[model samples]
Every structure is written in C-alpha cells, then in structure tokens.
Target: MAQRGFWIPLSLILVFASFVSLWWPGPNYGTDFRGGTEVEVVFTKAVEAHTVRQTVESLGYQTPDVVQVQDVKSPSHFIIRVQEVSSVTDATKEQLKKALCLTTDAAAAVADEHACPSNARATEVTFSPGGDKISTRYDSTPDLEKIKEQVRSVGGINLRAAADNPQIVNQRDNHVEIQLQSKGDQLMDGLRDKLGADTVPAQPLKVEWVGPKAGKQLRDSARNSVAIAIVFIMLYLAFRFDLRFAPGVVVASVHDAMVIIGVFVVLRKEITVSTIAAVLTIVGYSMNDTVVIYDRIRENLSKHRGKSFWDIINMSVSETLSRTILTAGVTMLSMLAFFVWGTGVIRDFALAVVIGIVAGTYSSIYVAAPLTEWIDKRMTQRLGAKKKRPSGKRRAKAVTGKPAEAK
Candidate 1:
C-alpha cells in the first residue's frame, strides 16, 4: 500500500503515453467505421496476398486490403476491401441528365411499350439538390430499362446496379430509385480478367458496403456506447460502495482501456467492431475484480474498527490475491487458446482480451484499491478539518476581523 504512491502515477504516465500514441499515428479504422467495399471470394487456386493486392491496385483503387482467409480446405478464400469507388461528378450528372432527357422512346425504348416516355412527352427534368438522386416523374411510367441502358452507355464511369451490391441483393425493385454504389461487380470482373476465369468465378461469396454517412453513424454509436458503459459502471460502483471507491473503479477501468488500445497501437493493427466488443468485455471483467476486492475492504473496515483505512485496504487486497491470480490465469489461458487457433478478427479479439486481463488484474490492486484508500484518507482529513473549525460567528469574525454577534 505504501508503494502505491509510486505505482499509481507510473500507471498514469503510461496511460498518458498511450493517449498520445493513439491520437498521433491513430488506429487503423475498419470498413465498419469508414465507408468502403468488402468482397469475399473463394479462389479455385492458391494466391499470394500481395498478388491479390496488386491485382486490385492495378485497377486504380487506393491500396486495397487483401487478406487470405484461413481454415479452409481445397479452394482458398480471400477478402478484399477498398475505399469508396463510385462518386458523382459534373460529367456524370450532365450525362445522366442528357440520357434521361434527350433519348426518345421511338429510338431507344422497347418496341410498342406504352410505358416508355419519349423525349417530347417527357415534361420535367429535375436533379436532387445536395444529394445523389435524380427523380423523373414522367408524362407516363417511363421504360426504366431504356433509361438504364442510356446511363450504362455513358462510359469511363464504373457503375453497378443498386441491386447487384456484392452478390445481387434479393430485392425486386422497379430500378427507378438510383444511388451511387461501390464497384463490387467491377472489382470481381477485374479480378477474373487479370487472374483466371476458373479461379475468380462469376459470383463471389459475399459483398458488403458501408457508405460515408452510415460509417459516421456507426463510429458515433460505438463511441457513445463505450462512454455509456463506463459511466453506468461508475454509477453502479457508487451505489454499491461509496463515492471514493466508485472513482477508483472508474479510473481503473479507463486505465485498462488505455492499456489495451496501447497494445494494438504498438502492434499496428486495425480497430474493428470485434475489438470494441473485446474492450467492453474487458471492462466488465476488470470491474468485477475491483468490486470483489472493494467488498472485502468494506467488510474488513467494519470488523477491524481499530485499523486504519490504508491497513484495511492492504489486508483486503492480500486476502483476494489468490482468487485474483487463479481467476486471471484461467481466463488468460482461455484467451490464449483463441489467439492461437482463431483466425482474423477472432484472433485479434482474443489477443485484445488477453492484454486486458493482465492490465485489469494489476489495476484492481495497484490502481483501484490504493486510490480508494487514498481518497478515503483525504476525505477523512477534510471532515476532521471541518470539525476543528470554529462556530459560525467565530468563523465570520476570524474572516472579516469583526462580527455583529461577537461573544
């Protein structure tokens, strides 16, 4: 307990260093937090990670991430992720508008189709302001296929169906509602053309996209959830113990989070939804340990009435040491199993949890318990100071040099 004066600040310094590191270089944000396209394809033959990456890069994408999926036999699988591809340009808008407005049903639409709106019959041509939407309420129900063909003819721009997302969304639509999409189809085509047709295949396993707007929302939600969890834990600890103890638990939890993130920063790995889940799990685990030791401290305080707060804290932590070591060791061993065998994100999550376990265990003792004792000691001194202060009128007199109610 006496050495805690040395330990607590050391932890703080370490956390500060981590905070700087996290912001300075920053963490690698995943597709879930940054708008991008992710395509999972099962290659008929083995392909190197760099080879796959180069194939995508040659297509003019900004350094796509190509990761080989493990635990598969025969056909190999790989996931490729790239930044947002299709963007609305002035040329796109003008060309799309021209395609919709200039082309006539007689010239372009399917023969004798009454739904096809000719260029003369088309009355209105309007584009959505501040968004990628072009609505054309026709004189009649326009031939959507003809319009699609016209837009498709506008070459140089890589565009795919709103429906053909990654593996063709199973939704039946009129193809009227149009929005910019990630070029998943183009990427698959590129892969097939560059590599072999047998290797790349027609349909990939899956394709998913996260737009910039959606990514921002997910990022904000993740940050808010983490904050909410920490605040609630602090509130629960305060109700369970007291203000002094509650702050210690909260600080210790933050300490553990910093350390876990620091481990990732050092390893130069990406922070994904899985990583966030692991972090939340670690917070709960560390909170449980701190709560256990604090409950013991409270019990000892009541039973050993003559002992100092510092002494009780030391005794309480000493008693829980066996439980802490055994619990942490067993939990860490399980995490190690996952780290060894689990692939990709699973491996990342396991490694994160393992780091948390070690950090959390140390924090329960050196950080949470010692700080709780320190806060109690300071609060006790403040209350004693209040007791030693003079009566109200005497205090007023001492402050103002004179008092109306002078005794």
Candidate 2:
C-alpha cells in the first residue's frame, strides 16, 4: 500500500507532462490531415534521403519531409512530402510544353499535323483528335497508365511515342479540365535532375494531395472517431461493471491515449490516419487491462469482506499482476518488431502501439485501480456519515417534546 504514495504522484506527473506536450508544440499532422502532397518513388538503384531533399529544395520549394521507406517485401523506396501548392507555376507549364514539343519534334516534324498535340492546358490534354479531353482533375496527380487507358478507350491513340519520350506525358491538370499539367510533373522533373534521369524510369509509385477543406474534414473525423470510441467504451464498462468502475476505466483509457499523443508530439512524428487507428486500438487495449484488474478487485471484495478497502485492492492487483504482464509483454514484442523493421506508416503505427501498451499497463495498475478505490472509499464514508445522523422522527419528537403518532 505504501507504493501508492509513489505510484499516485508518478501518474500525476506523467499525465501533466503528457498534457504539456500535447499543447506546447502539438502533434505534427501528416499529409492526411494537413493538406499536402506525398510522392512515393522507387529507384532502380539506391538513393539517399539527403540527396532527395536537396533536389526537392533546389526546385524552389520549401524543405520537404523526406523519408526512406524500407520493408522486407518491397524494394528500396522513398516518400517525399511537401506543403500543398494551389497549382504548378506558369513557368513550369511552359517548360513542360517546350520539353514535350522537343520530344514530338524528334519523332515527327513540329509542323506535322500528325505530331502529338503540344501545349494542351495543364488540366486537360488531347490524346486523339475528336476524342474527349482526358480529365486530369484529381486530388492528386493522375497515374500515367490510367491516363493512357482513358485515351485509348476514347480515341485509340498510340501511346508508344509518348511512352518513349517522357516529356510528351501530360503531368499537370487544373481542377477544370483545359490541358494536362500537374504538380507531379514538376516534382518528377526536379527528382530526375538530381537522382539521374533514369532513376524514375516509370511514374512514381504513388501520389497523394489534399486540399485544406478536405484535410480539415479528415482531421475532424479522426478526432471524432477517438472521442466516440471512448464514450462507447465508458458505456460498455458501466453496463458490465459497477458504475463506479466505469470512470476509472475511461480515465485510464484516456490517459493511455494522451500519453501516446504526447510522445508523438515530443518526437515530432507525423500523425496520419494510421495514428487514429493506433489510438483507438490503445483505448480498447487499455480498457481490457483495466477490466482484468477491476474484476479481480470486485472478486476480492466479495471473497474477503472483512478486509480493508486498500488491502483488498492491493490483494487484487497483486494477484492479477502476472497476467497483465504476460499479456502486455507478448503484445509489446510484436509491436516492437513493427517499430524496428517496418517502414513508413507501419512503423508509425507500431511506435504508437508500443507507447500505448506501456502506458495502458501502468495506468491500469496504478491509476485506474487507485481511482476506483478512492471513489469507493469516499462513497462508503458518505454513507457511514448519513447513518450516524438522527432520524427525522427523532428530531421532530425532540423539538416538540412529544412522541410522534404512528402513520
């Protein structure tokens, strides 16, 4: 029981530190929440992150968030994230047009009517005459293969010439389809300049872009999901256990979530949709651990009615400690593998899970159990005090100096 002195203050300190971290610097939202662009490129050969970052910076853009993606199943890959821009610049559009013209000229004379169309608006490109304009409008850059397929379906245009010359590929598109042009094309050019022309032999593996409004919606959805999960968990615990136990479980679950978010903020890790999933997972995990300890406490109360409240709590915790350790330990090992070996989103997810498991275990033992004990003790004291007070009939008799008649 003396350990409560240490555990209580330690929990408070941790909760306080987590709150500070949450508000001071805050979590770094990734492309999913914060409107931005993410490009995943797989190189024919290995490339360094610094080289990639430098190449992106030289292209007159802000410092990019560059990460080297590694996984057992996939080849070496790099994912680059940059703040979103409204559209590619006019200069970039002109440059791309000139490059495309040059490619077309090499294949056929620029004056040749058969030469591939050049200078299509950045949003729409004419792949074949009398064919529908290829709609380039998208949240992100459209895939070249997808574009080719659309063109083939509409006009049966030959893609061999465009495939041979990369410049002929329209990479930019405005929201309204006028011509084919996209920010992705600009990024591709920049990467090619630095990583060697052959590095990006094909289009990037992936491209994602989100506007401000969409990002806000995503951010709100992520937050609402976690909030809703907590509420439901609280309701479930209240129904399954005593109402007094529900608060403790809810508090412990929230504590686990806050601590994980705080660590992410402190480390400046990007929060993505995967992060929301991790937090929800932590909520469920923390609740499970707390429930085990709570069930033991309930059992101990019934089995050892004469024992003091603190003593019963201590006994219950002591009995369940081994089970809690075993469960959390095994789960932690799996999460650890993901944190160490997985890449990108998987690594982030694993890191959150690892932090969460540790926090959840500690809170279930020290925070949740102790809170329930305190609440129960307070309720007992209040009931004891009420019982000691004079009855209303006795008070009336004393005031009137006469015995009250039976109703």
Candidate 3:
C-alpha cells in the first residue's frame, strides 16, 4: 500500500497532461490545417534546414514549413513542405528548381530546360450578338500562336475578337489558365490542348486539398478507438474474473497510454495517421501484458487452497517477472531501432511504443497485480469474509484435560 501510494502523484501528473492536450491543441504543420498552401519537395543531398527555407525564399516564395521526413524504409530521402504556392509558372518552377538543386551537375543540366509559361490568359474581347459580352474561358493554357489563329478563324459577324492581349491572372508552378474573347464551348475545347495536358479546373484541386477535415477526422477516430479498446478490455476482465479484478488492469493500461500521450503532447510531435495506428496498437499490447498477470491471479486463486489473496497475487507477479522482462526487453530493442532510424512520421509512434512497453511491464507487475490484491482484500474485509482459522475440535481429542495417547 505504501509503495502504491508513491505512484499516485505520478499518475495525477499524467492525468493533468492528458487534460491539457484535450483543451489546448498543439501545433500542426501545413497551410491546409492552418489555411495555407503545402509545397512538398524531395531532395537528394544532405542539406541544412535553414538552407531549405532560404532556397524557397530566393525563388520569390515565402519561408516554407519545413520538416525532415525520415523513412526507415528509405533513409536517404528527404521531404520538405512549402506552403502557399497557389500560383506556379514555368519561370517560378525554374526558379524553385535552381534554388533547391545542390549538386553542380544536377543544377547545370536542368538549368536550360525552360518551357514558355503554360498558364491561362483570359480577357473580354467583344460584346456578344445580343449585346451581352461573350467571355472566352479556356480549360487550359493555350499556345500563344494557336490562340491567335483560333481568334482569327472565329470571324466577326456574330462573334468579334475584342482583345488580343493575353495576360496571366493566376499562376502556379505546374498549371495555368487564360481568359479568352468568347464564351463558346468550342473555343474552350480548342484552348484546352494548348494549356498543356495537366490543367484542370480548381474543383479538382479542392478534391486534393488536405486540411482540417482530414486531420480532425483522423484525430477523433484515433481517440475513439483507444477508448473503445479500453472499455472492451475492462469488460472482458470483469466477465472472466470479477469486476473487482478489472480496475487494476484498466488503470494500468490507462497509465501506459497517458504517459505516451503526455510525452507526445509535450514534445509537440505531429500525430500523423501512423501515430494513431500505433496508439491503437499499444492499447492491445499493454492490455495483453496486464491480462497475463491477471490470469495468473485467477489460476493461483483456484489452485492454491489456502493462501491469502495478497500472498497469491504477490507470488503470481514474482513468478511472471522473468517472462515479462524478457519479452519487454526484446521488444524494446526493436522499437528503439525504429525510433532511431524511422521516418519523422513514424518516429513518434516508435517512441510511444518504447514508453508503452516499459510502462506496461511495470504496471503488469507493480500496479495491476498490487491493485488487484488491494481491492480483493478490501472487499473481503468489507464482506466479513476474512480467512478463518481451523476450529479446535481436533485439539480436544489430544488434550482430554490430561496427557494424550501416542499414535
């Protein structure tokens, strides 16, 4: 009881951490989450973090939201995200390439490959036949020559070319669109091919948008899955042994989980999809460890005819100590490998597992088993069912108020 009391303060600290994270959300990268653009860049050379930002700024772009994505599967690659690149032109793309390319050979080779900007240019050229201005909207960035020829081909009896000057209103690194003198569908189609093969309406881009919706949904789902798993684990323990046997296992599993969550919150690690998956995985993992110790308690209760409950629990935990240590030790080594070498996305997850494995091992032996014994003893005392001493009926035969006969 005295030893268990020592954990109370630590447990309270972990609880407070969980509460803080619940109310005060932490930082999440990307303009999508915070309403900005996210530019992802892959690089081949080992580079400094600040240099990447400088490169982005040199290309007439703002300082990017940079993060090092370390992939254990492929350790050499890097992923850098730059937000707010809504308009990319060929010149801008060239500038970006020039800024990011580190190797002299790589930079020099791709330096000369500049294509005329393929973004669309649109302008109102003339009034429609009904005096309503007919606006020409192309689906793609049209070739300047093709656009001029198409304009001349449209002869001006009903449709007259009003403006021949092409201007880029919106630009992006990969795609652009131009306004035209006519609103006719045929003209829009003719302009589509010249806009290059990659242009699409902004609607498709919206479909590609990664923002609050996805992140929130992912966060909520991860939270719910952990909760449901714990509830079911408690229910199973209650059914198998007794509700009295459940609190210990549930508390221990929760302790492991809270520590993991608290560390992540403090460190400000991004809770990616992989991290969520890891949280769910650890729930099952830590619960399994607690259940093993609980199962031993059950076995000892049925097999040991007269041992006290606390004694039985203590013995069970002691007996399982070697197994728990061995399993957790091996697992910790593997998780350590993942943490050291894993990509940024999954690194936090691996660290969480490392924390969870240690916590789970402790709880199974110290928290869960001891708490089980504590609760069982208190319940027995309350019910007036303390283990009884043997009656003196047999002693009377030996005494007989005199010397007893030898067997």
Q: Give the whole-model CA lDDT for all candidates, comma-separated.
A: 0.77, 0.72, 0.56
Q: Model 3 off-target regions past 4 Å?
A: 21-40, 44-47, 54-64, 69-78, 82-209, 385-407
TM-score per candidate, in order?
0.80, 0.74, 0.58
Worst window of 10 by summed lDDT in candidate 2: 125-134
lDDT of 1 at 222: 79
Best by lDDT: 1
> How well does candidate 1 match the true structure in TM-score terms?
0.80
Q: On residues 276-328, what C-alpha lDDT tens digit does candidate 1 reach at each position?
A: 88889999999999999999999998999999888898899999999999999
Model 3 — which ten-residue stretch has the worst lDDT?
A: 200-209
- Residue-level lDDT for 180 in candidate 1: 38
Candidate 3 at residue 155, lDDT? 30
Estimate, for each residue in 313-404, the C-alpha lDDT of model 3 and write its tens digit. 77787877788888899999999998897755556778878878877787776677777877877887876743443235545554576444
Quick one: ranking by lDDT, best first? 1, 2, 3
lDDT of 2 by residue, 166-213 (tens): 223334532323233245555776678777787765688887777667
lDDT of 1: 0.77
Q: Among these predicted structures, which one has the highest TM-score?
A: 1
lDDT of 3: 0.56
